[model samples]
Target: MLSQKDEWVVEELVPIREKVYQYLKNEILKGELKTGERLVERELADKLKISRTPIREALLRLESQGFVTTVPRKGVIVSQISLEQVLEVFSILSSLEVLAVQLATERLDEFMTKELDELIEETNRLLAGNEDEEISQFHIRINNFLYKAAKSPRLYEMLSDLVDYIRAFAHIGYEVPGRMREALHEHKDILQAMSERQIDKAMKMTQDHIENSRKAYIRTIDSVKKK
Candidate 1:
């Protein structure tokens, strides 16, 4: 785990409350702040070198977003995501992302196609090197481009929220044998379909990719529980 001390430092430009919210949210998504971990307001404020007001506000926001919950005796703690919640989020994400892929394939211009090709090449390089973190970041960049090509702000926001909820488990899935290479191939298939202007093929591939991801996450979780 990285230093919490370093994680608390906020940039000067963003509002302290917003920054705190984003920081905590990112921490939760990254699994640095594990499920059921208590988030003490005073402790957070002290660590962040800020007043408790922003910490409280950030906690409230996190709670509303299902990232944390208020326990009767525990105060605020990171939320434990259930399998049902994971299934629900991933199902919606798959449907929305398929739509996004369809729109992007239709809307892709020459420049966007070139960019996707470049990203695919980068992903291939990262895959060959077995750079899991870099590959994950590249995958995110590719999805962000797809979302941008979709031209739907509301859709993007919805997809982002869904992705954030399950993102913590993504690395765990990557740890499964051969999962990284398989995911890279899946990504390539989707991108190839989109680049070829095969809208239906792209949409189907996107749905399949997300479904496989969901299954991988569940398998990882089950393996951990058995251990």
Candidate 2:
């Protein structure tokens, strides 16, 4: 079904490309690289201990994903997440997540529901402690489970891309005063709503939570601009 050269290319390049992609994506999302910062191909190649070809390929993929923008002469720059962009993304995410909640509620088996309940309890425990990093990881894990429960491959793929974009901006809000606590409460509300199969309440809670996060991020951006 495949040409020898094509198969060889796939075998050799996919792993390297995936590694490059993951490394760059993590650096960007973690704010190790800031928005609007230029990414020099050679510099990244050296920093990543890889050749330019793979670096270029990775950058191209990032560009496609809205994380980077290329200017003709100036090279690639990390695209800043604007307030408008944040609002638009959150709007889409709210709609998608509402759909996900609805689907997950309708389709999830008892075992899956119990698993989510356990995750919520674990999240509660983590939040009770001061482990911010663990809380964030658990929050992401819960969202991943929700995505799986949603069960629409196309929606899942789009949301996955959107979540990555949100993560890049979300790290800014993570330090906002009271944001972590607020998010914890909001997540608990969402989980309770899901547990009760209260679709409307779950959807509204998700929407409100995302809106609050967007506002927090906007405030943070404004403070940074003033400084």
Q: Residues 1-227, candidate 1: write the lDDT tens digits.
A: 33456555566777778988888998988778998999999998877778899999999988887889999987999997788887888888899999999988888888888998997787678777967777777767877888888888998887777777767534577777888778888988888888789998889889889888888888988999999
lDDT of 2: 0.81
lDDT of each: 0.83, 0.81
Task: Give the runs in model 1 whose Cα sits over 4 Å from its true position.
Answer: 1-13, 169-171
Residue ranges of candidate 2 with Cα displaced over 4 Å? 1-14
Q: For this target, which candidate reaches the highest lDDT against the unseen true structure?
A: 1
**Deviation in angstroms for 24 in model 1?**
0.8
lDDT of 1: 0.83
